[model samples]
Target: MSAADAELRQAFAQLQAQMVETQQRVSALEPQMAGLQRAQLHADATLQQLALAGAGGGGGGGGAENRAYQPVGRAFLLQPLPELKAAAADRRSNADAKLEALKTMKDYLERTLKNSENNLREMVQQRKEQASS
Candidate 1:
């Protein structure tokens, strides 16, 4: 093969490897994104429950005495209701941000894969024409 053909083949190989890696990354992100979405939904629900409880003054008439149990890793800790609500909101926001970032990465990988496929096809066509000539 000519040097140019060799170079094209090398580039095509690299693109194929990149495409495979990107697909793996996308596959990995799929489960993580689902988990994050579930966490966000849980947090939102917790926050809404807190809001409703607070609005109804249903904290056993002690108002600020309401407590909630929050999960920290594998353990649960007691925290004030307001603090728990704030933490849940923060968690939801963080999950939202991470989900967005993953989606963006997925989009970028897809576009790159498409472009690389087109480039490889063009290179192969050129190589075939050169061989025929």
Candidate 2:
């Protein structure tokens, strides 16, 4: 094969490898993303419930001393402990980092894949021109 063909083939192989790696990274992140979404949803629901309870009681004696709002088993408390809040913040930061990494990988793979396609098209055009001449 000509030098152009060789270069094009090498690029395709590298692109394929990058695609595979990116796919695996995305697959690994899927579960973590789902879990984070679920946790955020639960926290939002708990906050909404607290808001509704407050609205119903009009900030009276029943508002602050809600026995029903006692958090249990992953229930996000409106006033979480300081340590617990710190830990949760750390978890959120980690999740955000992973999500950003996944997005970067996806973008890189997309650009590289497009480059491979363009390179192959150019190689084919070159071959056609050579044949015609």
Candidate 3:
């Protein structure tokens, strides 16, 4: 085969390798994404339950002894709520970022594959013309 043919083959091989690798990564991420979605659903359910309990007087039912409870212990306990919110926000952001990145990578791989296939077809056409000549 000519140099052009050989180079075309090499390019296609590299593109195929990249497509395989990226697809594998995308596949691996899918399960994690599903799990995240499930976790988010669970968190929403828990938040709803907490809200209902708070409304129904099921929570904070400590009776007369709880009346003297001052601000000190409450402040310490309430401190973690902000941290928890921040953590959930961060996880959601990370999951969104990762999903976008995977989509971009998938798009790139598809484009590269298409280009490689077209180039290979053109190379074959050129080889045919050269042989005919």
Candidate 4:
């Protein structure tokens, strides 16, 4: 093989490896992304329900003694409604940030995969031309 052909082949192999790794990572993230989306939605729904309950009561003698329970490992902890609300809000924010980060990573991986594929195609074309010469 010509020196140029050898160089192109080596580069193509390396690019192929990188593309495979990127694809694997993207696959791994898909499930986590889906789970995070569900969590975000659940948190948002909980907050909305809480808001509705508080506002719709309109002085239904409920006082400020609202309460809730949050999971703590294998158990549940009783907390005042305000604390639960805060925790739910925090979960929502955290889920949002995580989802955004995962999306950015996926986007970057996709770009890398596209570039690698393009480079491989160009290399193949060059190698073919070299062989024909």
- Per candidate, the number of residue pairs that clash is 0, 0, 0, 0
Q: After superposition, how far is residue 30 of candidate 1 from its true place, in Å?
A: 1.5
Q: After superposition, which runs of candidate 1 have C-alpha atoms over 4 Å from their true positions?
A: 1-4, 57-63, 72-76
The prediction achieving the highest TM-score against the true structure is 4
Q: Where does candidate 3 clash, by residue pair? A: none
Error of 4 at 72 (Å): 2.4
Model 1 — TM-score against the truth? 0.79
Worst 10 residues of 4 by lDDT: 54-63
lDDT of each: 0.84, 0.61, 0.58, 0.85
Pairs clashing within candidate 1: none
- What digit string (tens of lDDT, one per residue) describes model 1 on residues 1-133? 5887778878889978887887788788899989999999999999998877666765367647777678889999988888988888899999999999988988987888788778778878987898899
Whole-model lDDT, model 1: 0.84
TM-score of 4: 0.86
Could you give candidate 4's per-residue lDDT for residues 45-133 as a string of tens digits?
A: 99987766555555444725666667899999877667778888999999999999999999998998899889888988987886789
Query: In candidate 3, what are the lDDT values of residues 1-133, reduced to their tens digit?
Result: 6887788678767756765775676577678667767766655654454444444543465322221211354462333333444455565666577667756776776676667567667767876798798
Candidate number with greatest lDDT: 4
lDDT of 2 by residue, 1-133 (tens): 5887788678767756766775676577678667766665555565566566555754446554543434558884555233333445565566567667756766776676567567667767876897788
Ten consecutive residues with minimal summed lDDT in candidate 1? Answer: 54-63
Number of colliding residue pairs in model 4: 0
